[model samples]
Target: MTTSEDTLESHEVGLAAPPGEPLQTLTAAEADGLELVHQWFPAPLTVRDGSFALPPEPAWRAVVHAARRHLEAMVGAVGRLECPELGPLTQCGSAWLIRPDVAVTNRHTILSLLDDVQRGARTLRVNLSAEADGSAVLHCPVTRVLYIDPIHDLAFLRVKQRGAPQVGLVVVDSIVTANPVAVIGFPSHAEGGYAEPEYQQIFGDGWFDREGRGFKRISLGRLVSTSDTLLEHDCTTLGGSSGGVIVDLVRGSVIGLNFGESRDRRVNLGVPGWVVQQRLAQLEGSI
Candidate 1:
């Protein structure tokens, strides 16, 4: 057995194992064999100031590939609909399921979808993709609003995705300045509906979706400013990424939620995980 100690040593040296075979999609059993699902450690990997200086190309690439692959099932998209019968009119934003039956997103996204509603109501269909290859798309309709905070533009939606496992949520408290972090989201420009992770073809590092299904956008940058107001960064988020999660790949926990970007689109912002915890508490009573 290649114990966790070996894996840790590999991680430290920036060695990346391809969760079993490197043929693209790894079966659940194969993924399990490689301990991709079980391995979550706090390493020194970070992207300071919206740029990735983490080097040793092959090692970082392998590291990034593993990170995004493992989290594929938990990350998803938030589609907008004026009428369910009409299908989706537009891709409202991005979101992730914190709980099996509950999802968190920006209130602005909820409102934006509601704004175009002509009569009765608007709907948010939680779209989850299975694996990085985009084989399966699981649909969970968000029926009711469980919580809402106007100031932070955060809201919790009730989604009952039939078989989704209840995922544990993690938050980082003590802020580390200028640490390289990853912002996982589905940017509108990237067309977060496809999963073409071939950006590796051009850029030696970063993984992006191409003409494939599911828009899982993983961008590398550093935690620019850990403010009480917002965890700002150069993570380069967009209109479709309003409710995406900002995770500390190093710490293996969520640091914040992607909300908006600067007027120049250079600086992206998110609500700190601390505030995320407080808001999440509001849902506990109702859940």
Candidate 2:
């Protein structure tokens, strides 16, 4: 147990764990949980070479099918934003790809794209692909300027792509207070990529509290606190991962999109779905 004084000192330095230790280490169970969750998705399923092909049991198969449908709802709808003036953008730092959906990252992750486009880039594209590795894809060109919210640092793009999901754009409504959430996306230049997403559940209710601004980005205690803007949960995300979706496990839907990680390395802030939805709605009338 740590004292209030220790907590204050740690916060002063923006560290979550004590010296010489890291925050959010995965236990054996947590690691296994992530793999199990991914197995529930079918399109991403593949029998690795030399691995034993154990047939999924009847009950397990049912679970997998259901999970796959829900995940499709979350991953199927992605926003593609780009500016040709900046050159073909690559998934580098804090950027990544998930099958069938090329995510347009948050303002901080790909600010250059936004800046150049606003400055009058003649062409821009947002493509949704079929693999996390960016294999087999559908490209969407940004033909019409949509909505943008500076306060929330979010934007919407009306893409031009053939055979896209009928839905305009979907976002997560809310996150479970003390349940699990998963971040799905590709990483920066990772060759041996995991076929499916990683899932991590919050063990307790620990939150990021900064004045009345109330950024929720920690999982501790039993009272799990949350914010309409920021989100806090126990999951792993890294470079090339900025625009990925944060799915609320209980709801089986995306609640947020990864934007930035806190200095503590324990929390990541996401653009809430409500913000994304509001921007898109405004664009509908204009379009």
Sequence-dependent TM-score of model 1: 0.63
Which candidate leads in lDDT? 1
C-alpha lDDT of candidate 1 relative to the true structure: 0.52
| Regions more than 4 Å wrong, model 2 | 1-66, 79-89, 92-105, 118-122, 130-135, 164-166, 190-225
The list of candidate 1 runs beyond 4 A from truth reads 1-88, 115-120, 130-133, 164-166, 190-214
What clash count goes with each model?
9, 13
Deviation of model 1 at 15, angstroms: 44
Pull out the clashing pairs in model 1: 46-180, 47-180, 47-181, 47-222, 192-215, 194-212, 195-212, 195-213, 196-210
Clash tally for model 2:
13
Cα distance off (Å), candidate 1, residue 198: 17
Error of 1 at 68 (Å): 6.1
